[model samples]
Target: MNPAAQEPLDPRDRPARLTVGVVGAGRVGPALAAALRLAGHRPVAVSGVSDASVRRAATLLPDVPVVTPAEVLARAELVLLTVPDDALAALVQGLAETGAVRPGQLLLHTSGRYGTKVLDPALRAGALPLALHPAMTFTGTSVDVQRLAGCSFGVTAPEELRLAAEALVIEMGGEAEWIAEESRPLYHAALALGANHLVTLVAQSMELLRAAGVEAPDRMLGPLLGAALDNALRSGDAALTGPVARGDAGTVAAHVEVLREHAPAAVAGYLAMARTTADRALAHGMLKPEMAEDLLDVLADGDSLGDTRGGAGGGAR
Candidate 1:
């Protein structure tokens, strides 16, 4: 037998069944632990920062002990720092200062915008830092726990930690996608722009409908909006509709005027987004490239489209 072939594979080179300790047992931590447990990982500990966190941990992950961060670090081979984004750095620093971080351990945080840099202290202590963010919203309910099993998670780490994080993601029943460190912010921003901003947009729409004396707001626009969102997700950018997509300068001007009349505060955001949509429409070949400049100028003026161009034709309202 060859010398290399005769040697046993190093443990680090192969996937190891890890004992996980979830820190910050609020909405995400317990949900993640439950998902991991369902996928065959052991939940060794859960650390909570506040009374609410403690109660949440008890309610969601009663099997796991609610302990201090130090205790969690001591017990778990992989420490998941699922604390609030603002607290992650402090938590890592604190753990390092206390010498709680174990050598040859794994440290992971779930913040979408942050990379492994936040866990530098833990990394310096010989732990490999990984950043894994599930691309799903948590509502702090059993539903969220259930939903986590099928979500897509963004996994980022140094070369040494990449396979380990991917294995964990796979074990959790989530699709693991790698993101480049520099692209993380743009990746996160796109999700926020599409998902988070949709909430605000829907709220605005519901408020407007209610103000217009729609007795059952949900009955009126909820299905319509839901279908639109479904279509957007299914069709991607081809779901672009309304005035800009059709190069309907008249309808576009009319909408700006009406929004200014009825919802003055919405005008700026409306115009800004309209300009962006027009750009997309042009890119999609739905609108002429020449039309984009005029549309942009009209939106930029924000007062009126005095010389608005383009005929209203085939766009969905």
Candidate 2:
């Protein structure tokens, strides 16, 4: 057995403060480097390709040198690879091939879709591998540093290095949740579905309101959407309301038709969400089986409501 494995880690103990290098001064990188600096770690160097990135690095880590990737890796005890997800693997391989990543250094990446396996080349070069992905979005500003506090980090690392990985997250003012190596993709997909798609959904709602000439659409949506989101988070399926949850088949059909006519681009998404909402409401007993059947029928037919606004007793076809 390795002697290092024999020593158990203390949960309360912090990882040793190190000279950190940020290998990509994008939004995530500089924000993270700033957090590390607040935690008493020194940011020695950063590598940035674009003008925006260089400016961000200067703003976030003023005294730190903006250097090449090789120099960043060579100069620091901890190297943070915060490049785009697509570029991560290749960067690691390049660093490893050029002998830039040395043994006994700690190597980490900020990619949610990937775990430590993507840093395999660095690991093979005798560096410790960790995946430390903050669950919040970044705006590449100082505000992001404040947002890091109380956020969750999806962490994946070797069993021996778990404590070290978690310690780093704690130092960055985040709680670390251990994710299985194989589950990283699913975990990331859930985040994207919730956070990324939600922005699109909100934009579509505001667009529809504008098209209908509603004054101050965002102001109209603010409280309602905020309350709905809060309630949904706190109550889950029980918080569901609206036509789909209430099993108002005619109303659902009318919504689809109006969206199709006005917001043609959003029609498909509306139908898909309505169907899913009805299914969940039914399963959760929020909607009766008969009502769910009617709703599903209306959604499937797409034109089930014939003159719903003008006519009474618009029977389901």
In terms of lDDT, model 1 sits at 0.77
lDDT of 2 by residue, 1-317 (tens): 23442232342342467779999999999999899999999899999999999999999999899999999987887889999999999999999999898777788999999999999988888888899999999999899999999999999999988988888899999999999999999999999999999999999999999999998999999999999999989999999999988989889878887887887678666766777787678778889887777787877776343322322222232
Error of 2 at 279 (Å): 1.6
How well does each candidate superpose onto the true structure, as a TM-score?
0.83, 0.89
Candidate 1: tens digits of C-alpha lDDT, residues 140-173:
7668777877789988889866777888888777
Worst 10 residues of 1 by lDDT: 308-317
Q: Positional deviation of 96 in candidate 2, in angstroms? A: 0.8
Q: Kindly report the root-mean-square deviation of model 1 from the true structure over all alpha carbons.
A: 6.9
Q: lDDT for model 2, please.
A: 0.86
